[model samples]
Every structure is written in structure tokens, then in C-alpha cells.
Target: MADSGSEEIAVIGNTDLTPSESENNLKNTMVEKGTNLLKRMEINVAEAEKRTGKNAVNMQETYTVYLIETRPVDAASEGTNPVPDSLWRRYSEFELLRNYLLVAYPFVVVPPLPEKRAEFVWHKLTADNMDPDFVERRRVGLENFLLRVASHQVLSNDKIFYSFLTEENGWKETVFETGFQAKADSRLKALNATFRVKNPDKRFAEMKHYGDELQSVISQLLRVRARAADRLYGVYKVHGNYGRVFSEWSAIEKEMGDGLQSAGHHMDAYAASVDDILEEEEHYADQLKEYLFYADAVRAVCRKHELTQFELEMAAQDLTSKKQQREELATGTVRTFSLKGMTSKLFGQETPEQREAKLKMLETQIEEGEELVKERNTECDEYVKSAWVDIERFKEQKDHDLREALISYAIMQISMCKKGIQVWNNAKECFSKM
Candidate 1:
């Protein structure tokens, strides 16, 4: 399939399955990926700043700005045929956009930004926590937030949303100001008034069913990818250990090969033996180091697998949250607020009829969210399958090299032992004649 779901066969170190596990899983994912429109307003965020920058003589800041790319796309184009326009924005900018939507369309549940986290010791500049990879993943989550909002009916049509999507000016502060206004316009008022979800229970149930399917696929893929990543990490460590060991062993073997070579007959035999062992070991040592170098390639794939799972997991969580939000609107009690930020329950709740209307709008969002999930799942499947091919090829080559190296070393040892026995017998014969 050209555009397929992300999948990989991890049976070697993972769970046992039939021999044709890859084929079977692929077949199953193919079934899950029902025919759905796979394109719309394309949005992507990349080129995240993963390093710290100097501000004043003593101050430093993490430059977490990312390039937000967007363009109109169709099912045929699918975000690639035509290039996208890119602009740089900070995580704060994305947060601003989301908050604005939350206030502007209180009736419409806005897609959320990822949880904003700060670390005192391991901030954005740190390798383990806020490295380039972590920044990149956060950027992807923010992009998904934008894409979800853009697909909504009322949210997509908002002028503020349009500016956020395409505007390149100092729109952030202005958007922040506008959003805090909370001033309702005629159109927003009309949306709130006319919105109604008839038979809310039936539609919520329908969306819940499809939403569950998308969640299952995403979660399963994450679990499988996680297993694969840990395995790849183990592989990297193995190669590195072998690389270090053989690398040191090769040096010692070379020292013996050079120093053990003196000019007498018995010494010549010893020299020859040393040379045989050195040649065998050095060749395989270089092989080990070469594979250790290749381990980088494996590590990169593992990172990509991690990223795929993360992006899909974010998408899945968004859908599930959206479902819950819809359910709350459909049947749950109204959100109540208190004066002076104090706890005081004194208000009339949303009517049963009122909740149903909001549920209708929410149902539309959930349905759209499900479609996006499927499209994402297909792309993820494609990535997982491709990564699997690279991983399997690496394993095969490693296995072959290991087997060949062991055989060559064994033969060298046997030859050296046989020659040593002959030399010992000849020396005894000489001593007896004397």
C-alpha cells in the first residue's frame, strides 16, 4: 500500500506468534484502515530549536521556537504534492492560540495543547529531558492540536483561527488580547443558540464505538513500538560492548603479534601462531566496530518508532478526551463557577434539552477526529513497516558476521594447537639424543 498504517514485526524478541505475523498483522491493519478521505488543510511543525541561547552576559534561554507549516491540500495531494508555507512560532504562541479558542467558542470544545512542563534541573537544554527529540515531539503534538481545530466546522471558520493558521505578523499578543475579551459576536451567539444534538445518546454511542476502534489501534501500535525500541536499545548496547571489547582485544593481540616474533625456529612457530590469531581477531574486531557504527542507524530507527507512537498516542488521547467532553455535555452536570474563586454551589444546571444540543456539535467533532485518527494510523503503519525492514536486515547481517567470525577463530586455534604439539615432540626427541 502506498499510504499505509505504521507496523513492524517484532516477534524475534517480542511476543510469539505465527511465522507469518507480519503478514497477518498487516492484513488486520489494512482492514481497520477503512476507506476515508486522507487530506485537508495540511499542517506540520518542524525544525524545533533544541539548544540554549545566550541572552545577556549571564542569562541563557532555551530557544524552543518551531516552524509551523501549512497549506491547502486535497485527497490527491495529501500534504506532499504541493509544498507548504512555513513560519516560526514558540510553544507559547501555540498555547495562546488554544486558549483563545477555548474562550471564543465555549460551546465548541477546543483541542488542547500538550501539558506544559518545566524542569528546574533538566530544562529544555538538557539532553535527557528537553533535548531536540523531546522538543520535536512536543512540536508535533502542537501541530496535531492545530490540525484538529482546523477540521472543526465553527472553529475552522473563525477569523482568529484563520489568522493563527496563516498570518505571519505579530499575531500572538493581539490574539491573546482578543481572546481575553470574551466578547461574543452575532455569529458566535447564533452558533450557541442554534446548536442542538438530537438523540444525543444514540450519536454519542456511535462516535464512542468508532473512537474506541481508533484508540485500540493506536494503543496497540504504541505497545508494539515500545517493545521494539527497547529491543533496539539492547542491540545498540550489545554492539557497543562488543565494539569496545574486540577493539581493546585487537590492540593487545597486535602487541603480542609484534613482540612475540623473535628469530629462532620455535619462536618462529610461536610468531606464526600469534600472527594467525591476530589476523583472525583483528578482522572480526574491525567488523564489530563497523557494526557498532551501524548501531547508530538502528538507534535512529528506534527514535522514529518512538516518535510515531507518541504522535498517534497524542491523537488517540485527543479523541478520547473529546469523547468524554461530549459525553459530559450530553448528560453530565453543568460546569459551575464561584465568585472570588471561592467554593459556593449556587446555580441552576444546564437543562437536559440544552445538553443534547451541545452534544450534536460535539458529535460532529468526534466523527471528524476519528477520520483524522484513521489517516494518521495509516501513515504510522507505513512508517512502522518500513522501519521493520531496516531492523530485520541489520539483524541478519549481524548474525552472519558473528557465525563466520566464530568459525574462523576456531580454525585458527586448532591449527595453532596442532603445530604446538609437533614442536613439543620434536624438542623431546632432540633432548633424548643429546
Candidate 2:
């Protein structure tokens, strides 16, 4: 979907997502300051190990943990450098960190983690978690996820991330103390209670729509790729059968027997090459899957923006209603029919002192409501600016990453075709000699 020249899917900031001049200037200043404050850290997930583990109940279980190595890139003053820090973390722990990030930084499009279990895999690819190839691919993906977070101007500076990288012991307890999961649950409940936004920004609406479209397109692509790979595998296996038939026929020949056997060998080699080629293709497919999962993160940001806008509108509406009530009280007239006015008419008009007291209470509430409105407005504005800045950065990264992935995939396909052609050409020469 992210074609090189097509701005439809790749370009997120050119439209209403573009910030105003003041916001743009503010974003630039904030980014510059953030860059200076955040240190560059090298993070890697170089290996994985499957280990037998004991559960809380003393039950035995098996699990895999990844080795994470991190070091401050700029720590060296001139020559001497500190030793790199290393830790082993379960995949579940990575989930914990990512969940915290999503909750803590709702405005940011947090990077998605690789799938814990494989799906839509072909025959050659196993769904088993402990498969060496699958584990290696996942390790690479986890590394990429860390690199993405480590490179972020905002995410890089998070103390929790540092703790996740270096603090092997009591990390979960530290994360629990932050109460992030409780906050996320509370937010989810609020969202579930009210799914409507009175006023939605057009930019975020477009972004949410883009997220859906991107997810859909990428998912369909992966499905097609899997199906194509299955077919390709079968084709290569059929050629292997053809090679066997050729060798068997050569056994009954005389002068051309040698040529036929050699041609059969060439076919066998060509057929065997598909295994490695398809294995390499899995790497490219993983890249596509990365963007496929990223679509969800984009929607999460949009949903957070909508929540902010909804709160702002609710606050402003409450302020307006309070002001209107104050005006009606002072004017001795009801702008709209109310139960309180009917009650006053049936019982008796309140004394001037009581009326004045009620007016003062209304005035106090009006002031507080006005302040709340202003605060919510400011919150909404800041969220929009910060979210847009990150979105702009994300769009650039997405474009570059997808472009490189597609280019590499194309090169791989071209090389596969050339190798196939060479194999057949060699077979053809053997036949010519015969």
C-alpha cells in the first residue's frame, strides 16, 4: 500500500494533519530539546533460549527468553568505554513493557511487538513456538521493536524502558507500582461507556480511516503471499518429480543416457533451491507483517485524540450551561423550561437573600467550569500537536522502511528467476550435446 510515488497511503502530514505555523515551530523546538536530553543507546536481541521453568505452583513448564544487550553509544569520552549491560527477558515481559508504553503514551504510536504465535503459515513454516527458524525470526523482530523505541525522541527517554533493558530483577514489581494497567483498564471502561465523539477532527478521522485501510491491504497481501508460496513450493516439488522421471528414463537409453542423467541432476538442483529461496522470502514477509501490525498502533493514537477532543467538548459544554444558568438566575427569567422554575412558581418565589446565595454558588461553579474548559482545551491542543509530530516522523519512517522492504523483495524475486533460467539453460546445453 505504501508505494514509492503514491502519496495516497504514505503521506500522512500533507493534509489537515499539517500543524499550524506556531505548532510546527513549537514541535521543532520541543524535538530539538528532546534530542539533546535523550541519549543514544544501542539495543540488541541477539539470541533466544528455550528453558524449563517452574511455575508459582511449583509446576514444571517450558518457556523461551531472549537475550537483550544494551550500551550507551556516546558513553565513551575518547577511548575507554563501560561494559555493555545484558539481560534475559521472556516474551511476556516484552508484552508488559509495550502495554505500559501504550497506556503511558497514548498520543504516541507505540511500536507493536511481534506475534507470540505464528499464523497463516505455509507447510514449510511451522506454527510451533520453539522452532529454530521461527524463534530466530522473532528474535530479529524483537530487536527491531527495541530499536524503534530506542530511536524515538520521546520513547527513548522513558525510565521504564531503561528499567526493562537493564533491570532484570523486580522489573514487574516496578511496572506494577506505576499503576499503568489500572489506568489502561479505567480508560478502556470509559471508552466502552461512551463511544461517541461530539466533534471529531478531520485529520484524525482520516488517520483512523487510513489505519483501517492499511491493515486491510497488508493483511490481504500477506494472505496472497502465503498462498503463492504454497503454490511455488508445489511447483518446485513437481519439478523434482520430473527430475526423477528423467533419471529413470535415462537408465534405458544408450548415448543420450549421460546427457539425460546430467539434465536430471540440473533439475534436481533447481528444485532444491526453492527451499532456501522461500526461506529467505519469509524474512520479507515478516517486514510486511510489521507494518500490518503497526496499523493498529496508528488507530490507537487516533482513538486517544478523539477521547481528548470529547473531553474538551464536554468541559466547554458544561461551562456554557453553567453560564446560562447564572444568566437566567440574575434576569429572573428562565431561558428554557426547568423543573426548578416550576417548583418555585407552585411553592413561592425564594427570598432575595436565597436568590443571591444561589447566584453566588452558580457564579463559583461557572468560574470552575470555565477553568476546566480552558484546561481541557489546552490539553487537547497539546495532544494534537505532539501526536502530529510523532505521526509525521512515523510516516517518514514507514515510507522508507516499506520502500526498502519492497525493493529487497523484488531483488530476491529477480535473482530467483535468474537462477531458475540458468538451471534450465544448463539442462538445454546438456540436451544439445546429446
Candidate 3:
């Protein structure tokens, strides 16, 4: 007789189980098998842990699992084509198997579990062979996973998980930490080195305190310099004399130079201990540029104002002097002519026509002087008016420029404050994570 197991078997179609009953039976079988497997795995892990003095493994700790339910797009239409329920059921089974293998025999390095690999099988079943939505979802899931890993300190520190998650193959947290620390240490050392160079000749130096004071003084100086510039500019606009304005500017410049020199000398003397002198030097350089700009503006205003005032004053003085000389000349000529007439009358008798002629000539001379004086006065007034208008214009421009500079400075300060807060927040996070 033929072997019983080898005998051919055939089943005829019979109206026996409904589709829902068949699905329920499959689900029951899957639940039973999964429960059994889970029990066995737990027993094995417990035994291993007892022998090795390690904690028992748990499913949550060892594996990450995701479950998805898919429904047919046209499920509402009875006759419309729909995704077979078998495909979804098969996919679920595969996922369960994959998760089990990943947790139960993590070191085995086996090929992906066959039942859990239904996504690939599904792709083969489709004629168009594309699941764009599924692909997009998977991509998004992977990206999110990576972001979590990167942000998580524990997972990021784990060599195995970190290597698997990151694109830089074989990367380790320890190695990364070492490199970061080395860079930080090098930067610190460089800063310290700078201190040494700055303080080479000093002994028992208070570099930190000195540097702080230096910064404070420099800040005050900057403010003072700004105010000085404003005042100088104002004075120059009103005075309009290059010579006078420059003279004042020269004095201020000297004062600034002296202040800088004094600061430098102190820095040099304390160089053996001070570390941030170079920073101070850079600050001073910037302040110097601002100071110079202010000085130039003031000088421009002063020169213009002074020249206008000088012209006006000179014109007025010349007119006054001319008027006085004209009056004296007229009086002297009349007296001289009168004396001659008196002498002629007492000794050699003179005519009235001669006296009248002398008087007319004196009157003509006086009238010419008066006209010259009047013309000079008119010029003086015009010069004064032009000078005043220019002074006002210069004042307005100076004020506008100052206002713009102030606004820019304020904005910069606010930006810096915001950046400082952001940096502090990042540092706090880093510290907590570490």
C-alpha cells in the first residue's frame, strides 16, 4: 500500500463557514500562538538573567513596534474593487513576527522574518507596483525617529542605537564628546595664552580686575566723547569760524589722545598680568573713528559760522570808522575855511563866494562818506542773514545724523540682548542633557 502521508488529498467546495467566521478563527489562532511565544520568551529571559546577574529583558525596552490599519479606498461600494482583507491580515502577522524576532534573538542577525515581510510581497502583487502614500509615511516616520534619537541623550549615547540611527556609520558618542571637549579646551587654552602674552612682564598682577576697570573706563569715555562731539558740532554751527573751531577741536583731540595714551600706558605697565588689553585696544580704535567723525562735523560748522560772522563784523567796523573819519574831515574843512575868511576880513578882505565854494566841497565829501557807510551797512546785514540761515541748516543735519546713529545703536543693543538669551537657553539645555 502507498504511504498514507503521500496520498493525494482534495477538498470539494462546501457551504460551511462564513467569511466572518473564518476571519475570527484566524484571529483566535494568532492570539493563541502570540501568547504562547511571549510566555516562553519571558521564561527564557528570566532564566538567563538569573544566571548572568542581569535584569530581565522586557518587550518595551528591547524593541520599538508600530502598527497600522489600512482600509480600502472604495469600501462603500459593494461591487467596487477593494484591497483584499488577506493583505492587511498578512501584513499584521508579519509585523508581529518581525517584532518577536527582533526582541527574542537580537544577536542572531537572521534575514528579515518571512511572514513580517509582506510589504515587499504586496508591492509585487500590484501591477503598477507603487505605494507612494505608504512610502511617504515611512519616510516621515524615519525622519521623526531620527530627530528623537538625536535629541534624546540616552539613545544618542548608546553606541548600537546611535550607529543604527545616524547616517555617519559607526559614529560613537564618546568619540564625539572627546572631540568637542578637545576643541573647547583648545579655545580656553588660547584665551589663556593671550593673557600670558598681554602680561609677559608683570608679577602679582590683577589682570581680571584691571581689565574690568579698563572696560568700564572705556565705556564712560565713549559716552563722554559722544557728548563732546555733539557739543563741538553745535558750537561750530553757531560760531562758523574754522580757526576757532579747529582750535577747540585741537584741544579736544589732544585730550582724547592723552586719555588714550594714559590708558595704554597703564595697560602696558599692567601687561604682565592683564589678559584683555588687545580687546581694549580694538575698542579704543572704534571709539576713535567716531570721535574723529564728530570732530570733523564740528569743524565744518564752526568754520562756516566763523567766516560769516567775521565778514559781518568787519563790514560794520569799516562803516563805523568811515563815518567817523567823514565827520572829522568835514568839521576840520569848515573850521579851516572859516579861519581863512576871518583873517582875510581883518587884514586882506575875502569874498562870500569863496567861503560858499569851500562849504559846498566839504558838504560833497561828507555825502560821499555817508553813502559809503550806508552801502557797507547793507552788505553787513545780508552777510549776517546768510550766515544765520546756514547755521540753522547745519544744526538740523547734525541733529538728524545723531538721531539715526542713536536708533541704530539701540537696535543693535536689543539684538544683542536677544542673542544672549538664546545662547543661555542653549547652554542650559546642553547642561541638562549632559
Candidate 4:
């Protein structure tokens, strides 16, 4: 967060000027700017009032104010990291705050009154001005704003936030009344100051540095696990040639298992860190579910492509029986094993030519199974992509519906506000005429 220099209190609509026209001229200019800003805000408020068929004065209240300041710290030194120039330059805290207010105000202001037409202007005004926790309340509002932005995974992507302006039902009233608007405004001001001092490039660089390190650890672990699985698969496929494949399989398995275990441990720790920051328990659970889905998909591929337990067991039995038969022949005891019995052989060693042929046949079967697994994996990837697309589309539709509702509500509010303002204005006119 960044500071907007020092804070100075200016009268809401001061008109008096002393001897210095220069000072007065500047003051007048600022006043006009402030007035215009307020008028624009009032217009929005009026629109909300009209749409809701509620009087604006009935909802008006004094809001607490707070200020947040951001200053830069040396990146090379302790307790500081640099941010990217692009982010600092492009991101606007003010705009974000404004958006928050636009969404949250309506819900916070004006409780239901029994008589919809009843005038509660004085009561509302008095309550707003008299609240003792105004300043503290404002601080809480700022905290909420920060929490929402920092914790929002979708918005953190940056692309998503930039691409769409999400709308909500009766957003204007929800934002202002809830004090989300004020809080967001303050936080944005603070963020602006921080961006100016720290810059976005430095911040992004730090994030990338950490992200890469974490990803590397995860990658290493996955590779190790995959290697181990491959070694086990090779051993099962070797049939009677266990001695030939044993040494090779053992070495590969050792290397892969070590790496995989280490990487998995690191990933688990990082995930825990993420969980700590997320307040909503369900959010973390949802993320876990998604990760599990991906993991299961990967396992499904392996299962489809690799040799099954039944195939491995049969191969092993056939190899043992063939070795026994060869021993008997060497001892001049010819024991005939029928083709039917050979067909049930586990290691697939029957006749000399049949053994060779079976090996080739098994190889072809394995390849075909692997191809099917690959196709399934591709389908799974496509499904994941389609799911995300659907989610984005749903969000867009939700936003549209909310906007329509808000506009309708705002129109009603504005009509009511205009009527109130008109009555007040007319009273002033009548007073002047008198």
C-alpha cells in the first residue's frame, strides 16, 4: 500500500477566501473536483434508490474513515522484496476499491422498515454520526478488502480479473451499507503507495523465484516415483529372464523411489502452507479434490498400460514348469506336458517355437494397451480443459444476471433518491422564496 502524501482535511464545500486569491483559487478548484466526485456518487446512489424503491436519505449514514500508507524496503536487505514495474504501473488500488464498494454497499445500508414510505432520514443520519466504533469499523473494512483480494485464487491469476467485471444483485446498496466500499477505497490508496515505492517487477521476481524452486522439487519427486514404477513393470515383463532384468530394474527403482518420496514430501508441506492462509475450510477441501482427480487420472493411465497381476503370475508359473521339464529331459525321464496343460501355464513356456511366438504376442498386446491408455489420458486432459471453460462460462452468466438485477435495483433507488433530493431542494426553494 502507498500513501497519498500527508493527509489534509478540507471543508466539504468551503467558499470563504482570504487575501491570497492564489490559495483561494486552488482551494476552489479542489472543492469543485470533490463536489463533482460526490455528485457522481450521489447519482449512483440515487439510481440504486430508484431501483429499490427506497428513499436514499433513509439509508444515508456517516461512515468511519481510516488511512493506510505503504513504503518501500530495501530488497537486498532484511524484510524486503522487489515487485514488477508492470504490476505497479498497471494495477490501480482506487479502481479495485471502487469496485468493492459497488458490489457490497446495498446489503449493509438500511434495514427493512415496516412502512416502506416511512421517512427515517433523521434517524439514519443520527445513527451514522453517533457510532463510536467508526474508525475501528473502517479498519475492519480495510482488512476485509485485503483478505478478499489476497485469498481469491481466481483473481490472483490476473488474467481472469482483467477480462471481466463481475456484477452482483443490488451491488451499490450492498457495498456502501456494508462499508465494503470505504474499506476497499482505503486499501486501494494504501496499495497504490506501496506499488509506487516497491514497484511490481520486484514483487513478481520474488514470487517467481519461490514458485520455481517449489515446482522443481515437485518435478524431481514425480520423476523418481515414475522411474520406480517403470522398473517394477520391467521386472514383471521379464518372465523367465529374471536374472537378466533384476540388476537393471533394481537400480532404476532405487533412483526413482528416492526422488519421488522427497518430492512428494515437499509438495505436501507447500500445500499445508497454502491451507494456513485460506480461511474457508471448504476452499482447501475443494482444491484437494481437484488434485486428487488429476492424480487418479494419472494412475488410471499406468494401470491400463502396465501388466496385470494375472498376466505376471501366469508367466512366472510357466517359466518354473519349463525349467523343471528341461531338468527331467536331461535326466532321461521324458514327462509329456499336454498342450491343454501348457495352455494353462503361467510363464507361457510350452514348445520352443511357441515360447518365442508368445513373447511377440505379449509385446503386441502391451503396445495396444499402452495406446489405449494414451488415448484415455488425452480424453481426461480434454475433460479438464472443458470443465474449466464451463466454469468460466457459468461465472459470466452469473455476473450478467447480477448486473441486470443491480441495474433494476439501482434504478428504483435512484428514483427514490431523486424524489427525496427533489423534496429537499424544493423545501430549500420554498424557504428562499419565503
Q: Which regions of candidate 3 deviate over 4 angstroms? A: 1-369
Candidate 2 on 1-434: residue-level lDDT in tens? 11112111112221123235224423322223335223456678979999997988999999999999877667765565887899999999999999987876677788899888886577777899889898999999999888887667666556678788888999899889867787788778766775678879999999999999999999998899999999999988888987898899899999999999999999898889888888899899899999999999999889888887888888888888888888888888888899988998999988999989999999899889988888778778777877887777789889999999999999998998898889889999989988
Global lDDT of model 2: 0.80
* RMSD list, candidates in order: 19.9, 6.4, 45.0, 36.4
How accurate locally, in lDDT, is each candidate?
0.49, 0.80, 0.33, 0.32
Error of 1 at 90 (Å): 0.6
Provide the global lDDT of candidate 4 against the true structure.
Answer: 0.32
How far residue 103's Cα lies from its native spot in candidate 1, in Å, is 2.5
Give, for candidate 1, the lowest lDDT window spanning 10 residues: 7-16
Query: How do the residues 15-46 of candidate 3 rate in per-residue lDDT, one tens digit apiece?
Result: 12244632432332211211221221111000
Better of 3 and 4 by lDDT: 3
TM-scores of the candidates in the order shown:
0.34, 0.89, 0.26, 0.18
In TM-score terms, candidate 2 sits at 0.89
**Most accurate candidate by lDDT:** 2
**Decoy 1 TM-score against native:** 0.34
- The digit string of per-residue lDDT tens for model 1 on 1-434 reads 12211222211211112347434433432212222121346677756765577855868886677787776666335534656777777776776776565444332324456435411111112334365444654665677567655544334545566677678796776575543544334323433453333222332234334434534553454345345434533543443444344345445555443222221234334434443343343343333333433443344344334444555666777899778777555545334442411322345455668667778878898999898788667655655554455344445555686578668756865875686577556544533443
Which has the better TM-score: candidate 1, or candidate 4? 1
Cα deviation in Å at residue 234, candidate 2? 0.6
